[model samples]
Target: MDLSNIDLSKFDGLAFIWLDIETITGTGVYDTLSSPDTWFVHKNPDVCEDFICSDLKNKQIFLITSGSLGHKIIKSIHHLPQLHSVYIYCQDIARHTPLASEFKKIRSVCNKTQSLISQLAIDVAHICVNIGDQHSRLNKHKQALVWYERAFEKIKQHNGLTKNEFVNALKSKINISTLECQRFQQHRQQLGEGMNEVKYQHELLRQLLDVPTPLSSTEKDDKHIAATIKKIDEWERKNIQQIKTVAERVRQQLQKQINEINKVNKVKHDFRLINDELRQRQSEDDYVEADLQQWLERLQQLKHQLETTTISDTSQIDVQITDDIDWSSMVKLVESDVSKTWVRTREISMVESL
Candidate 1:
C-alpha cells in the first residue's frame, strides 16, 4: 500500500471502484451507483492496483471491471481480504463466465447495464448482512448493529429483495439495538450497587477509627506483628540500596556531561579574543559605526554557535522501578488467625479461571 496517499480524515468503510479504459465521468454507471462517498474510477490498471492496495484500513472493495482487464487485475488482487467482490462488465458474458468461475470473489458476469446495477445492489445488501453476521459471531455488538443497519437501509432501497429478507433485516437491527440498551441499563444498575457497597464499607471502617484493644495479649499475635514489620523493614533496606546504586551511576554520568561542558568552555575561550579586540577599539576611539557593526555580527555568530551546540553521548537518563504486590493479599494477613503458621496468599482464583 502507498501509505503516503492515504488521508485518514477521509476514511470510508466501503469503496466502489470501476476499472475500465473508457472514462466514467460521462458514463451513466457512476451516476447510477447509490453510494458515492468512496466511489472511484480508473482508466489505468496500475492506478487501480495502487488504489486497491492503498486502502490498508480494511475497507470493503467492490470492483467492476471490463472482461479484458478483469483476468489481469483479479489474479493479482482477488486474494486480498479487503477485496470483497468483483463483477465482470463486458459485451460477451459467455466469454467471461468461464474466467469468472475460476475465482470465488466474482459475483456475476453481466452484459446489460441495468442487470449489472440490480445485481450490484443485491450483492451490496448481502455483503452488509454477511459482515454483520461476522461481527455478531465475534461478539462485537456495536459494530454488528452498525452493519445490520446498513444492510436494512440497502434492502429498503432495492425492491428486488424478498419481503421476508427485508423484514428479517429490520428485525435483526431492532433486536440488536434493544439488547444494547438493556446491557447499558444493567451496567448503570451495577454501578449504582457498587457505589452503595463502597459507602457501606466506608461507614464500617469509620466506626473503628476510635476503637482500641482489638488484639488480645498473645505470643502468636506478637510474632505475626513482628514478622510483618520485619518484612517491611527488609523491603525498605533493599530499595534504599538499589536507589543508592542508581544515584552513584547517575553521578558518574553527570561527571561525563560536565567534561563535555568543559570542552564547550574551551571553544568559548576563542571568543575572548574578539571581545578583547572590541574593548581595545572602543578605548582607543579607533572604531567607526561600521567597525562596531562588524564586531556585533561576530558576537551574534558566536551566540548562535553557543545556542546550537550539542554535546555527544550525553542525554537525560530516567529511572524506572517496577513494583509487583497484591495489595488485596496483604489485607488477608490482618484477617488470618495468627495461631496457625503464616501461609503466603496465592491468587488461586485467577489461576483456576485461566
Candidate 2:
C-alpha cells in the first residue's frame, strides 16, 4: 500500500488505532505492540473485568484479523462507554459483515492488505496524537501533555516532517499542560473549601458544647442538675486520660520497632564489614579453626602412616601425638598468645603416597 495516499493529517483531533487480533493468541492480548494507542485485547472470561471493559478512552480501534471471535467477546466491546468506533478488517470482508454488525460502535468494516509499510509509517506519528486525544477526553490533561511531548519527539526524529508539523505538535503540548495546571488549581481550591466547611462545623459543635444549659431554680432540681454535671465532667476527664494513655502506648510501640530495625541494620553493617575484611586477606587459603581433639586425631593418623611407610628415617617428615600432657599448662598456653589457631593439612593423596 502507498503511504502518500494514506493521509494521517486527518488524525489531528481524532483518537483511533489499528489492532491485529490474529496475533493475539490464548487468553490475553499480545503485549509486544510498539504503539501505546493500539492494544491487542484478548478474550479471557476469568480475567479481571476492568482489564477487558475498562481503561479505554474515546478512540477508534480496527481489529485486523480474519474469522469470527466468540459471541461473548464481540458483545463485550459494546459495553465500553469510551469507545467512539470499532472497525473489523478481515480477509473475506463479506463473510464477517453480518457478524461485525452484531458488535456496537463498529463504524467501518474493511479488508486486510498484504503489505503494511505505509500503515506502519502513518502509525509512527498518529499513535501519539490518538493517545493525547484519549487522555484529553478523560480529563487527564497532565497525561495528555506527556503523549503530546512523545508525539513531538517522534516528529523531531522523522526527517520528512516540516517546521509547521513541529510547531503544531509543540502547541498541542503547551495547550494540554496549561489546561492540566488549571484543573489542578481548581481541585486544590475545592479541597480548601471542603476543609473550611469541616472547620466551621467543628467550631459550631464546640460552641454548642460550651454553652450552659438552663436549669430549674427549685431546691429539688438543684441536686439533680449538680449530679448530672459531675457525671459528665467525670466521663470527659476519663475519656481524655484514656486517649492520652493509648497515644503514649502507641508511640512506645513504634519506638520499639524503630529500635529493633536499627539493631538489625547495625548487625547487617558489621557482617558486611567482616566479609569485606575477610575477602581482603591474602592468606585466606591457610585459614583454620582451633580444635584440640581434631588436631590430635590428624597427628595420630600421620604417625600411623609413618609406621607403615618403607622410607629412610631422615628422608621422611615425622609428626607425633603423645597420650600424656600437662592439661593445666596446655590450657594456659591456649589462653595466652602462644597457642597456634590454624594448622595446614596436606592433601589425602600426599599422605597415601607416603
Candidate 3:
C-alpha cells in the first residue's frame, strides 16, 4: 500500500510524505522531505537543491519507487543527517546499479514487482552487491563478486543481469574483468618458475573473460608464441630450398651418366668397324699365300725334268759309239770332231753333278 493511503493519526508524533522521486530528473529521495521531529514522509522531489538544504531532524522515511534511481536522488540521500537508514526500492531494474559507500551502512531493495516476493528479491541483490563491492575494493580476485552474480541468478528472468539494467551490468562486468586481468598478471609473476606462466595466464584470463589469450597481458606470452611461429615458417622455407638443391644435384648426375653411356656406345661402334676391316684384310692375305705356294711347286717340277732329260740322253749316245777305230773311215769321217764334242759334253755333265 502507498504511504498516502495509510493512517497518520495512528503513527503519533511522526510526519509522513509521498515523494515520487523515481524517474524524475534533478529530484532526490531525501531532498523532498522537511520534518522537525521524528517523522515519516513520501513525496516527489523538487527540480532544484532547495529541498536538500532544508533543515529537519529526527526523521523516519520510506523512499519507494520504480525504474532507475538517478544521481541526484542517490547523492542527496547521502547528505541527509536525519535519515539514518533508507530503503530505495525499484520495481523496474534489478541486479545492476552503481552503489555508493553509504550503501554499506544503509539498505536498498530493487525489484520488478510490487509484492513481498519482489521485495525479498531486492533484499537479496542488495546484500550481495554490498558485500561484493566491499571485497572488490580489497582486490579479492573476483572471488567475492561470486556472491553478487549468484544472488541475481537465483531469481533471474530474461537473462541473468536482467535486460532492463544490463547496460549498467555490462559496465560493471567490464570493470570486474579489468580488475581480475590485473590480478592475474600480478599472480603470474608471484607464481615464479614452479608455475607454467602461459597456463596460468590462460586459465586466469578464462575466468575474467571468454576470449583468446591476449597480447596485452605480458611480453612473454606474445613473444614466445610469435617466436615459435617464426621458426616454423623459417624451417618450411629452408626445407623447400633443400629439396630443390637435392633435385638439381640428382639431375646433374643423371645427365653425366647419360654422357658416359653415349661415349661407351660410340667406342663400341668404332671397335665393330675395326673388327670388320681386319676380317676383310685376313681374307686377302689367305688368297695371296695360296698363289705363292702354287708357283713354287711348278718351278721345282720344271728344274727336275730338265736335268733328267739332258743326263740320260747324252749317256745313251756315248754308249752306242764304239771304241773301234777304222783308218779309212777315221780319215774320211771326222771322229776327232765327235771325240771333241763328247769331251765337252762330259765336262758339262761333271759341272752339273758338282
Candidate 4:
C-alpha cells in the first residue's frame, strides 16, 4: 500500500490497515477479486485485524499522539503520550526512532538564555563599581564604601553554583575583600599621619610669629614691637620655601593615598567580577581592569613625589632697639607729688586703694 500521501484524517472512527506485498503469483488476485479488496474476504479478515491491533498498541503505548487521525477516531484510548509533549518524531517500521535534532535545539536555547542572564548580572556589577569609584573621587568615603561593598556582594551572588562551589567561592571573595579594605585603611592612616605633620609645621610657624623681640631699658615698647615685626618679615622670607615644601608634601601625600585606595578597591572589585563571569559562562572584558592599573601607577608617582620633597627651617631674625631716652626726667615725673596727688584723688584710684 502506498500510504505516504494518505491523509490519516479521513479514517475518523474506522479501523483500517494498509499492507504492501510483492507476490510472484500469475497476478496479484484472490477470491476472484482485485488485490486491493482481497484482504476483506472472510477467510483473510484476521490478517487485517492482526496488523491493526499491533500497530495501534505500539503507537498508543505512551500517553498520547497529536496525529489528526488519533484525535478524530480515539474514544477511550489509554496510555498515549500528550500531544503537546511530542515535539518531533521520525519512525521506521523496521527500526527504532532517534531524537538527536530536537534535543540539540532545546539544549542550545537553554544555554543561550543562561548566558544572557549571566551577562546581565555582570553588567550590573560593572555599573555599581563605576558609581562607587566616582563617589570616592568626590571624597564621599562612606557612600563610596557602601556602593563598593554592594558591588562585591552582587558579584559574589553571581558565583551561582552548588553548595560546595559556592562555599569555596564565597571564602575567596571574603579574603579578597578583607585585604582590599585593609589596604585602603592603611592608606587613610598614612594620609592622616601626613596631615598631622603639616599641623605640627603650622604650629611651629605660629610659635615663630609669637616670639618677642628683646627691648632696651629706655626704648618705648612700640619700638620693640616694630623691631620684632621687621625680624618676622626676614624669617618669613627665609622659611617660605620650607613651608611651601611641607605644604606640597602634605597635598601630594593626601592625593596619593586617595588614589591608592581607589585603585586597590577597583582592582579587587574587577577581579571578583571577572571571576564570577568566568564561572557563570559569560564574556569577560578587560578594559576596567586596565584602567584601574593605570590609576595605581599614577598614585605611585604621586607617592614618590611626596617622599622626595624636603622641608628646611627658616633662618632666625635679628633686631636692635636703641637706648636714647632721658631716664632721670622720666623717673622724676613718675615720682612727682602732683602726679602722686592725682593718682590718689581720682575716684577710680580711691576704689583701687581701698
- Using TM-score, give the best candidate's number: 1
Q: Rank the candidates by lDDT, best first.
A: 1, 2, 3, 4
**lDDT of each candidate versus the true structure:** 0.69, 0.49, 0.45, 0.39
Best by lDDT: 1
Task: Report the poorest 10 consecutive residues by lDDT, candidate 3.
Answer: 345-354
Indicate the residue-level lDDT of 128 in model 2. 58
Whole-model alpha-carbon lDDT for candidate 1: 0.69
TM-score to native of every candidate shown: 0.46, 0.28, 0.22, 0.21
Instruction: List the candidate 4 regions with Cα displacement exceeding 4 Å.
Output: 1-119, 122-152, 155-174, 212-354
lDDT-superior candidate, 1 or 3? 1
Q: What is the C-alpha RMSD of each candidate to the true structure, in Å?
A: 31.9, 39.5, 42.9, 44.9
Instruction: Report residue 25 deviation for candidate 2 (angstroms).
Output: 10
- How much does candidate 2 score in TM-score? 0.28
How many steric clashes between backbone atoms does each model show?
0, 0, 11, 7
In model 2, which regions exceed 4 Å deviation?
1-65, 70-72, 82-85, 98-104, 113-142, 150-354
Instruction: Tell me the deviation in Å of residue 343 in model 1.
Output: 38
Candidate 1: where are CA atoms >4 Å away? 1-12, 25-37, 165-170, 189-354
Q: State the lDDT of candidate 2 residue by residue for 100-208, as single tens digits.
A: 5676445445563312222332344455556666666777777667767666555544323546754476666658677786888899899999999999999977764
